[model samples]
Target chain A: GAGVSQSPSNKVTEKGKDVELRCDPISGHTALYWYRQSLGQGLEFLIYFQGNSAPDKSGLPSDRFSAERTGGSVSTLTIQRTQQEDSAVYLCASSLWGRNTEAFFGQGTRLTVV
Target chain B: GIQVEQSPPDLILQEGANSTLRCNFSDSVNNLQWFHQNPWGQLINLFYIPSGTKQNGRLSATTVATERYSLLYISSSQTTDSGVYFCAVDHYNNNDMRFGAGTRLTVKP
Candidate 1:
């Protein structure tokens, strides 16, 4: 992809529904990151992936929030049984390297639970 | 855990004005980044100033890693600069990144 791309630019779902958000990182980029922003993203680091290595989920708010990367190019974030509080803009980014590298972000998925 | 702080939680300036935003972290960092979130909520990377200074068009950033602070300078600002600016850093020992609440700038035309 030309840059980090996220699917379902905007989503509206009812409580208790499960929603899946997708992120396609830049080719050859090894690091993928996810962050959640409410009303706007407040810059909270949600999860990150470096190759096939286990993802760092320390920032996930709860078990309801989980993500997986297929191979190393694409990732998905699934929020199960969504709650009204789950409404937020979920962002995905990628970088050619690690922390020292600049990360490129997607437009983000705006999830709204009513 | 490392703490990140951004000064002037909120700012309003006229287009063509210049402003400086600051970020302070609690510990040594190998990585430091600045991002701008536009009205539509998209983050645009401004610089990777883990150390030293770098400039891109109207924006320039400097980080003194040893001192644990970074500064972002926006010169001849425009209405497009209106958005939230964030600073994020990784601890010397961790790969995880943490962020400050952010500085919201509103540039009026």
Candidate 2:
């Protein structure tokens, strides 16, 4: 793909329903990241996967929010029992092996929990 | 965790006007990038300048790593330039990123 790709650009779900947002990072990128942006707010770091290391999940707001990167490429963020406060634009980004390099971002998935 | 702060929470400028936005950080960082979130909610990368300066068309950015501050300059702004400008930073040894509150820009024609 020319850029990072995210599936289901927009998702609306009832409370308590589980929703999975997928991100396919750029080919061979060594690092992947997930972020959430509330309306009119800045990006909030959710999780990060770098190579085969255990992901940095410190930013996950709650136990109900979990994300995993499989085979070091495609990643999925699952929000279990979604809440209205979970409504936001979920963003995915990938970068080269270095920490200082620029990362490419996906268009993002807008998730609305009602 | 690094603290990033952007000044001028909101900005309103007329078309053809010039403006400067600033981002100040509380800690040293290895990665500093600027992004623009358009009205449609697409975040477009504006610059990846951790240090030094770079320019793209009507937009230019300068980062003074020693001072822990960065500046974004928009020259001859257009209505289409209206959007939220964000600066993200990552610590030198950590990949965990953080973003500032951002500057909301409105360029009126």
Candidate 3:
């Protein structure tokens, strides 16, 4: 892919439903990141995945938020029992490596929990 | 955790005017980048400057690593430049990139 790509550009789910957001990173990139942005707020770090090593999940807001990256190429963010406060934009980004590399972002998925 | 701060939370400029946005971090960083989020919510990478200076067209950036601060300069601002500018950094040995609150720029024509 020429750039990072996210799936289901928009999602509307019930308050108690579960939603999954997917991200396809650029080819050969070794790093991936997931972030959340509420309306009128800055980007909030969610999870980060690097090549094969243990993922840094320190940023996940709660136990309901979890993510997985398979084969270091595609990634999925799962939000369980979505709440009204979960309505926001989910962004995905990728970089060549952790150090001294520029990151590119996807268009993002707007999740609306009704 | 490194603390990133951006000054002049909001800026209003007229077309053809010039401005500078600042970002300060609490610790040494191995990666620093500038991004612009347009009104439609697309984030575009502006620069990947951890240290030193670089320029591109009407935009330029400078980062003094030792000083732990970076500056983004916009020359001859245009209406299209109206957006939120964000500064993000990654600490040494830490890949968890953090972002500043961002500076909102409004260029009026």
Evaluated with lDDT, which candidate comes out highest? Answer: 3
**Candidates in descending DockQ order:** 3, 1, 2
Q: Give the per-residue lDDT of model 2 (tens digit) for A1-114.
A: 789999999999999999999999999998999999998888988999999998989889999999999999999999999999999999999998738889878999999999
Q: Higher DockQ: candidate 1 or 3?
A: 3
RMSD of each: 1.2, 0.9, 0.8
Using DockQ as the measure, name the better of candidate 2 and candidate 3: 3
lDDT value, candidate 3, whole model: 0.95
Ranked by lDDT, top first? 3, 2, 1
Instruction: Give the CAPRI class of candidate 1.
Output: medium
Best of the two (1, 2) by DockQ: 1
When candidate 2 is compared with the true two-chain complex, its DockQ is: 0.73
Worst 10 residues of 2 chain B by lDDT: B90-99
lDDT tens digits, residue span B15-60, model 1: 9999999999988888899999888888888887899999999899
Q: Could you give candidate 3's per-residue lDDT for residues B1-109 as a string of tens digits?
A: 7899998899999999999999999999998999999998999999999999999999999999999999999999999999999999988756777899999999999
Error of 1 at A106 (Å): 0.6
Which sequence of candidate numbers ranks them by TM-score, best first? 3, 2, 1
Candidate 3 chain A weakest lDDT stretch, 10 residues:
A95-104
